[model samples]
Target chain A: MKRHQNLLMALAVVVLVALPLWMVHKPAPGPDGKEAEIFAGADSQAEGLIGRIDPGYRPWVKPLMEPPSGEIETLLFALQAALGAGFIGYWYGSASTRARLQREQETTTSC
Target chain B: MHIMEGFLPAKHCIAWGIASAPFVAYGLRTVTKRVREYPEQRMLIGVAAAFTFVLSALKMPSVTGSCSHPTGTGLGAILFGPAAMAPIGAVVLLFQAILLAHGGLTTLGANIFSMAIVGPFAAAAIYRLVRAARLPFGVAVFLAATLGDLLTYVTTSVQLALAFPDPVGGFWASFTKFATVFAVTQVPLAISEGFLTVIVCNALARLNPRELQEMRVATGSEQEVQA
Candidate 1:
C-alpha cells in the first residue's frame, strides 16, 4: 500500500503537468491576428492586463542585464535548473552513502 | 508571480522593498544562525534552496491554459521554518532578476514579498495547523505546499491590484481581474508542487533520518525513518 501510494503521487504530478497541454481548447486569435499562444507564462498575461487598464503607464526601469535573446534566456533558466539539480544530486548521493555505511556499521557491531 | 522588472511604479517598488526588508533581514540572521549552530545540516539547506531554484525555473502548463511555476518555498518553510526561506528566496529572486531577466530588479521586493515572505509564512502556519489537527503527514505537507503556492499568486494579485486599480470598479474589480489571471493559472502547478514536496520529504525521511530529526521534521509518525 505504501509503495502504491508513492507511485500514485508520482502519477498525479505527471498528470498535472500533462493535463493542460493534452486537453486545452485553443484560445481566440491575439491582437496580431494569429492564434493565441498556448501555455504562455501568466506573468506576461498580467502585464497585458496592466496595459489594458492603464495604457499611459510605461515601465520606468529596465533590467540592468537581460539575456540578449530568447535562446539566451532559456539557456540561463536551464543553467539555474542545472545548478539546483547538481546540488540535489550531491545531497542524495552523500545522504545515501552515509545511510548505507551507518547500516553496515550497525550490523558489524551487532555481529 | 514575478511582476516583471519595471512593471511596478517607483513608489510601489520602494513600498514593497520596505515591507519585505524586515522579513529578509530576520531570515538572513536565521540562516546564519543555522549554519553556525548545525554545520551538519548545511547540505540539506543547500538542497532546499536548490529545490526552489529548479522549481521556479520550470514554467509548467496549468489547466487555465497558461504557464506558471511553483515557488518551491513551502518545503523549506515546513522543514526550516518560514523565516529561513526569506533569505533563500531573496537569493533566487535576485538571480532571476539579474541573469534570466524573468523578474526585474525594480520589482524584486514585491516579488520576494509575495513569493518568499508571505508564501512561506502561510505555508508554515498551515503546516502547523494541519499537523495540530492530526492530519496525516503527507496531507499536512501537501496542503502546506499547495496553499502556499496559491497564496503567493494571490499576494501578487493583491500587489498588482493595489498599484493599478480599475477606473470603473476600483481595487476589488482590479483584484478580481489580476487574481483571475495569476491565481487560476497557478492551481494545477500548486498541486504538482505539493506532490513533489511530499515525495522529496518522504525520501529525506528514509535516507537522512538523522538530518530530519535534527531539523525537527521527523516528529511522531512522520518519523518513519529507516529502522
Candidate 2:
C-alpha cells in the first residue's frame, strides 16, 4: 500500500507536467476566437512585457558565454538534469541498501 | 524565476547583490555547521542540491499557455532549513548563468534572492505553520512546496516591476503585468513541484527514516506516515 502511494504520487507529477501541454494543444477559443500561443518560457514572456512597458529600456550586461545555439542550450539543460538525477539515484540506492541491510541485521539479532 | 541576464538595471543588480550577500553567507555557514555536526547528512545535502539542479532544468508547461520551471528549493529548505538553500540555489543558478546562458551572471543575485532566499524561507515558514495546525505530512509538504514555487515567481515579478515600471501605470501596473506572465503561468508547475517534493519525502521517510528524523522532518508520532 505504501509503495502504491509512492507510485501514485510519481504518476501525479507526470500528469501535472503533461496536463498543461494537453490543454495548450487544444485550447478553448478565446474572445477573439484565437488559439493561445504554444508554451513559451514565462521568463521570455516577462521580457516581452518589460519591452512593452518600457521600450527605451536596454539590458546593460550580457552573458559571459552564450550556448551558441538552441540545440546546445537544450543539451546543457539535459546535462544538468542528468547530473542531478544521477546523484539522486545514487542516494536512493545507498539509502535503500543501507536500510535493507539494517533490517536484515535487526531480524537476525532479534531471532 | 530568472529575471534573465542583465535584464535588471545596474543599480537594481547591485542592490540585489548586496541584499543577497548576507543571506548567502549565512547559508554557507549554516551548511558548514550542519555538515560538521552531522557528517552522515552529506549525502542528503547533495541530494537536495541535485534535486534543485534537476528541477530548475525542466521548463514544464503551465495552464496559462506558458512554461516555467519550479525552483525546487522547497525540499532542501524543508530538509536542511531555509537558510541552506541560498548556497544550493546560487550554485544551480550559477551553472545556468555560465553554461546555458539562461540566467545571466549580472542577474544572478536577484534570481538567487527570489528563488533561493525568499522561496526557501517562505516554504519553511509555511511548513511550520501547516504542521502546527496538525495537517497531514503530505498536505504540509504540498502546500509548502507549491506555495514556495509560486512565491518565487511572484518575487521575480516584483523585481521586474521595480526595475521597469510601466510608464503610465507605475509599479503596480508593471507588477500585475509581470505577475500575469510569471506567477499565473507557474500555478501548474508549482503544483507539480509540490507533488514531486512529497514523493521524494515519502520515499525518504520509508528508506531513511533516521535521516528524516535527524532533519526533524519525521518527528515522533508524525513519522508514522511511512506506513
lDDT of 1 by residue, A2-100 (tens): 557778999999998998888998978988898767788999999999999999999998889879999999999899999998999988898889889
Put down candidate 2 lDDT per residue, A54-106, tens digits, no spaces: 88888888889998899999999999999999999999998899988988998
Tell me the spans in candidate 2 whose CA falls farther than 4 Å from its real position. Answer: A25-37, B219-227
Q: After superposition, how far is residue B99 of candidate 2 from its true place, in Å?
A: 0.7
DockQ, each predicted model: 0.84, 0.80
**True-structure RMSD, every candidate:** 1.7, 2.9
Query: Which portions of model 1 show Cα errors greater than 4 Å?
Result: A28-33, B222-227
Per-residue CA lDDT of candidate 2, range B80-121, in tens?
A: 999999999999999999888888888999999999999999
